[model samples]
Target: MGLLKFIAVGAAIGYGINYITKKGPNGRSILDDITEDAPEWFNKAKTYATEKVEEVVQQARPNSGY
Candidate 1:
């Protein structure tokens, strides 16, 4: 089955490409980034991370006392 072999090879290549793209720092995943906005949960998570970063920065500075 030449047809079956071709299908398998195509699938493997597609999966490999997807894996590399995700693992690499290529900014955005092809599927999710193109298909949808960054979800609300992600936005909320980013806000929390930013708050923590600011807190750490204030603590590190001299007499900032934030």
Candidate 2:
């Protein structure tokens, strides 16, 4: 019973992946859209983290020198 359930779930997931990867009326696959935007999000996160680390260093510098 457990094995059958697992196979059914796996098939459903595989079907979903196949469906999304097909181009819609817009002429672009769902995977293409997601991958296109990934880099922008990654760069934004990197910038935000750098700014935060700089702030922390600036705050600690004054205390240490005193």
Candidate 3:
């Protein structure tokens, strides 16, 4: 029973992967879309993180007479 369950789970995962990678009528798979857009998404996230870090650093610093 345990072996059968494992096989069934494996098969389900394989099918899901196939379904995602299969091209649609527009000729692009889910993976293709992700590959195309991932760079823009990553850059946006990185910029947001950098701004937050700078804000925190500024708040942490003590006032200087300068």
Candidate 4:
């Protein structure tokens, strides 16, 4: 029953994404813009995570800097 529910949910989400991304006002598929910007978004997220990790490490180190 749990597996069936998961499958149903997944299918619904897939269908919704397909429907919404089929085309945009510009006639280009929404996925085209998403794919173009994915790299930039991923890089930003990576930078944010890296900065946070460095912050945590610095906090863990005593006398590291004040």
In candidate 2, residue 55 scores what lDDT? 89
lDDT of 2 by residue, 1-66 (tens): 999999999999999999889998989999999899999999999999999998888888966763
Task: Please say which candidate is ahead in TM-score: 3 or 4.
Answer: 3
Question: Candidates ranked by TM-score, best first?
Answer: 3, 2, 4, 1
Please tell me which predicted candidate would have the highest TM-score against the true structure: 3
Model 4 C-alpha lDDT per residue in residues 6-52, reported as the tens digit of each score: 99999999998997689877898877888999999999999999999
Stretches of candidate 4 off by over 4 Å are 1-11, 64-66
**Selected candidate, larger TM-score, 1 vs 4:** 4
How do the predictions measure up, each by TM-score?
0.38, 0.68, 0.76, 0.66
Model 4 CA lDDT for position 43:
100
lDDT per residue, candidate 3, 23-43, as tens digits? 999999998999999999999
- lDDT (C-alpha, whole model) for all candidates: 0.78, 0.94, 0.93, 0.90
- State candidate 4's TM-score: 0.66
**TM-score of decoy 3:** 0.76
* Winner by lDDT: 2
Q: List model 1 lDDT by residue over 1-63, tens digit each.
A: 999999999999999777756834767666566456558768889999999998889879969
**Lowest lDDT 10-residue stretch of candidate 1:** 29-38
